[model samples]
Target: MTQTASPLPERGPTGRRTAKGSLAAKSAQRVERPAPLRQVVYDALAELIINRTLEPGQHLVEADLAEYLGVSRQPVREALQRLQTEGWVDLRPAQGAFVHMPTDEEADQLLGVRAVLETHSARLAAGCASEAHVARLWELQNAGLEALAADDGEALVTANADLHSFLTELTGNAVLAELIGLVDRRVRWYYTPIARPRGHDAWAEHAELIEAVAAHDVEKAEKIMAHHTERTRQAFHERPEAARE
Candidate 1:
């Protein structure tokens, strides 16, 4: 005779399902786990790429990266595959992995989007800024100047980003801030090479922008920001080491 499977009993031998037993089904959901090794490796490699430590088109040898990151080849291989999917790396049939070299078109498109978002951000900031906010903007401007004077490219990039980021914060628009955050790292990556060359002029534009916001000159702030971002886009196109490959 064929037998049918029995359903799990709601009541235990004690005539009731214990609370502990009821919770067993939900235990796995509640347990927290640290990031997987592959994920951690992916983040580290992506940062290296974004910061230009892993320059575009550089060969990524799995064993070398594994040793450098103090992990085995497996996670590095996994991370590189993920990077390739995300356009940060390119995996070849026989040549292994390489960093993705952004084209002029790619840079232009991203910077163009950045200009639009930032122009609006400046306009909103001008209408919303207080004396305290203007002071913060000046503080950031001063920091940028100090970085420029010291010829510290890294610090200059950070200060430039900080000042722009503050303007977005002044807008009090979460959605706008999220949009800018998406492109922020890529913008930093592109800006790094031109940071020193663009330093003085960029900071001067920044000063004018701060003044417009301080005066609550909304239209002036918008126009200044549009010009400022367009100039940076042009500078990237004219970069001495312009990528042709």
Candidate 2:
């Protein structure tokens, strides 16, 4: 009867029109491939631990992490393995992973090692530091002071890390640099909860250390660096929050 508009061009089973025009405007949509699944998991979990998003001694379930991160057990397993290597996590047989907590004694030992490494670092810096190196360290030191004055704990920590890394590089020995970097990471874990360090005192100390390095006064630089580590260690040891651990 009425020609039926040529049967309205029949539809697909799901009511999509069976025509080129209904398929796509130009091409099929392509999903963006994600990053390496293991990297994704490792970085995500590492950040969680570093930021204290996961509390010390909290159990980490592979299944839960896999589900939460939208990956499978494979990535989670790899990530946990990496965290264990970094000493940020512990894997107990059949007990699952837990965030690692270092005791005061362990912290003290790490800080002691840091002191030695950085003292040698300061000595080397005094021996061969360029004016530019000194300038750069000074810039970072000033920035760190400003961060502390503003009561910006996170910013101060980041700036402090930068200054330390700069000194590590300036030490000119790759081995010493590596050792300093390792200790630096350990130090920050304990330093985070401590109060904002006094900016002027810190800057003054840095300035004195820089001058000592510039003059190649190895003894002065070494002594200052040692005192700096000792002060930091004492502060951290007395910090009430650190006591909680």
Candidate 3:
């Protein structure tokens, strides 16, 4: 005679496995939803570095970071390695990790390339931006002005980036947008230190730039963007903290 198959595990009223089920099988079925420890650590440390919470050239010890982040040294070490590869941290052979200090030349080169890309973006945006795009640009401009008035440097910087990134998207050039995005984070890091000083002037320039785009004046839009980005490049060089090697 054929034997009957064993009954499948039963579920409780709560929809979980009953006590009769194997705990190991239940545990195995549960998947952790959070990011891996290493990525979490990397993101935390990167934010600190970008926002200047972890200043450039400051030494980073794995143990201290691990303790601060409530993790073990393994994840911290992994994070630092990844940060180094991404140019956010520099790992010396025996000296450990330090925040990467961007040189003036590096800043100039990146900003120069940014200005070129963004000038073209503005030219395209002037012709292509719809009434809705111009309205969004005005909204971002007002947000930046409000942030400046409130002395919220972080919010101002975010608004500034949002406005530019939106304009870049309006360019309708995927390749150009990708190139700008590649340098965007580093540009933000550079800009954060000078956000307060640059706040008023930057937003004012944004107002004129928006007008040019809204008028669909390609030449005026391109000129205003070039000037705006160049002024930012100059402001970065003028900051005292940026003088540090």
On TM-score, the leading prediction is: 1
Runs in model 3 lying further than 4 Å from the true structure: 1-35, 241-245
Q: 1-245 in candidate 2: lDDT tens per residue?
A: 01122222222232221337767666776778878768877877776665555656667777666766666789889989999998989888866687787677987898899889888888888988988988888888788878877888767767877887888797779988877766676577666656364345555777888889888899999999998878778877776754355
Model 1 pairs in collision = none
Rank ordering of all candidates by TM-score, starting from the highest: 1, 3, 2
Stretches of candidate 1 above 4 Å error?
1-35, 242-245
Off by over 4 Å in 2: 1-36, 63-70, 92-95, 195-203, 242-245
Q: Which digits, one per residue and each the tens of the lDDT, describe model 3 over residues 168-196? A: 99778999999999999889899988899
Candidate 1 or 3, higher TM-score?
A: 1
Superior candidate under lDDT, 2 versus 3: 3
Candidate 2, TM-score vs. the true structure? Answer: 0.74
